[model samples]
Target: MKDMITHIYKGLECFLLECSAALVRRRALGGWRSDPRQLREQRRDEFRARKVAE
Candidate 1:
């Protein structure tokens, strides 16, 4: 019974670690594309202004 409990506890620990790692990876990826929409809008405005100047 003690062995079974230990196994379950270990499994839970592994699961928690995996979840934390995934959360960290997700946060890192989120930072990469954080302002994509805003950046796209800014780029479009700049492009339009450049065309007007030309």
Candidate 2:
């Protein structure tokens, strides 16, 4: 029926939109931890842990 076809079309359109949005979010956040400040902090933490273990 036409109603069923319309429902299916809407569902596919929503799914495609969600997929594209997720791809955009992935690209945007892919380098989230590459910030120099965060890297430095992580290194500092590791160094402190090593010092504590020794």
Candidate 3:
């Protein structure tokens, strides 16, 4: 009984992790992109410039 509960808990943890990662990916991508060209353009626009030390 205890082993079964532990297995179930581990499965739940995996499920939660998968869902969270999917959400994070969606947020990072700024939502879904149906068109390939537009998606590329959108991604390009999301880039940021950083300062470099000389």
Candidate 4:
């Protein structure tokens, strides 16, 4: 019984850690998407690429 509980606890802990990591990654990416400077830089890169392709 003790081993079973320990196994379950370890599984839950791993699951929670994975979820936390995913949330952190999502927030980081979300910040980049919402950042004005990042958006502007992306747009500038796109424009430059288009100009070069022409």
- Please name the candidate that would achieve the greatest TM-score relative to the true structure: 3
Whole-model lDDT per candidate: 0.65, 0.64, 0.59, 0.66
lDDT of 3 by residue, 1-54 (tens): 999999899778766865665566566767764455765564444332111211
Regions of candidate 2 where Cα sits further than 4 Å from its true position: 31-54
TM-score of 4: 0.54
In terms of TM-score, how similar is model 2 to the real structure? 0.56
Q: What's each prediction's TM-score?
A: 0.54, 0.56, 0.56, 0.54
lDDT of 4 by residue, 1-54 (tens): 999999899778766865565456557768445666765575567556755975
Q: What ranges in model 3 sit over 4 Å off?
A: 34-54
Best by lDDT: 4
Q: Candidate 4: where are CA atoms >4 Å away?
A: 31-54
Which tens-of-lDDT digit does each residue in 1-54 have in candidate 1? Answer: 999999899778766865565456547657555566755565567556755975
User: Could you give candidate 2's per-residue lDDT for residues 1-54 as a string of tens digits?
Assistant: 999999899778766865565455446656544455755565567556755975
Off-target runs (Cα >4 Å) in candidate 1 are 31-54
Of candidate 4, the 10-residue stretch with the lowest lDDT total is 17-26
